[model samples]
Target: MAKAQDKEAKAAAKKARKQASKERRQQLWQAFQMQRKEDKRLIPYMVGLFVLIVAIFVGLGLLFGSVWLLLPLGIVLGLLAAFILFGRRVQRTVYTRAEGQPGAAGWALGNMRGQWRVKQAVSGNAHLDAVHRVIGKPGVILVGEGSATRVKPLLAQEKKKAARVVGDTPIYEIVVGNDDGQIPLNKLERHINKLPKNIDGKRMETLEGRLSALGGRNPQGPGMPKGPMPGNAKVRGMQRTARRKG
Candidate 1:
């Protein structure tokens, strides 16, 4: 009886994994279809990369008199290279589309994977400009997105509020834009991650708890969508999938 139960459990787990795999593939297909509509060069670039990688490997194989042995490896590596290229292109496309939109910085911050405790739209105004709060090893990061002129005051205001609660915890303010002093939306995550680690995990948690008392603002500016714009969230998922599967 135990053996039968164990077998059934194994089968169920396998089935679940298969279902998840199927769903992931479907999501990828959907993303590819969506991206292809706007990015005509995606397939061509992928194919070109695959061919280039394979040709290089084949050349090396010929030089070493091991064409047959290296051929399969080459094909496998070529496919991987192509997939990674696809992922990068998808990521770029998503960032490009999402950039400059109201709450875009919050959306990007919310998507970051880490020990970060992110609160989006912590402060904003009627113009849809927003300040997002992030707490991590680097302490507090206030990322503002929207009109550069409008966002500066919001960042400063939010920074003051954050300082009142965070005390001496290192607080960093960033504006997302293409301007000289601002960080681009795509590079936002990298920039934040590179900041000096000023606190430990325990301190970060304590900081988060303290900041929670400060509450947050949800400015539903006219015409501001409640979540990421259509297709933006889906593409972000595809970007993660690409990074993992590639």
Candidate 2:
């Protein structure tokens, strides 16, 4: 009787998970539809991707004389291509919306893969200009967003404070914007990823601990949300879908 009851409970849990997954997919589909209304190129891009994949696979099959074997492979590749293109579009849309918004730099850092520790709104002023700090294998990275003239001083001050605590640890600075000498919002993640990894995992943990002791923004100052901003849920949804598909 105990075993039978256990099986029933397991079945119920499985059914609940299936329902949750179905709902999530429905939500993603609805989000995609709404995005398509603004992204006029989405359908055309998918159609072009399908046509290109079919052409390449059909050509290879003709040369190999394995048309049947390659036909299904072609369909699979086409679908994968469509999915990737969709993800890219979603990412672009997210960045476009996030650009110039307060806390966007922190949001981007939070979404990055790996073991980096992010502290949002470490320093800011009434103008909405802010500095966010990230601790990773590369050491401390200070990212500033908002007016270059104002943010330069904020980043400098934060760097000095961080330097006092993390002696000899390499500190890299980045400004997020489209202006000269600034990294574009879309390329921010790639830029950080390319930085030289100066420290190992153990050292990274040590550095994170030291910075944590320094604490974050002043309790009296305004704070930006640590997660992605509103209307950017679709980007997170796309990331989830890609992870599951992978």
RMSD of each: 2.4, 2.3
Stretches > 4 Å off in candidate 2: 218-221, 225-246
**Model 1 global lDDT (CA atoms, 0 to 1):** 0.83
Give the clash count for each candidate. Answer: 0, 0
Backbone clash pairs for candidate 2 read none
Candidate 1 lDDT tens digits, 1-246 = 999999999999999999999988998888788778889998999899899988988999999999998889989998988878877788788788888677677777877777899887888888888888899999999888888899899889888887887888999999999999999989999999899999999999898898888876754455444346535567777776765675
Q: Hey, what RMSD does candidate 1 come out at? A: 2.4
Candidate 1, which ten residues in sequence have the lowest lDDT sum? 218-227
- Tell me the tens digit of each residue's lDDT in model 2 across 99-135: 7778788888888878888888888887778889999
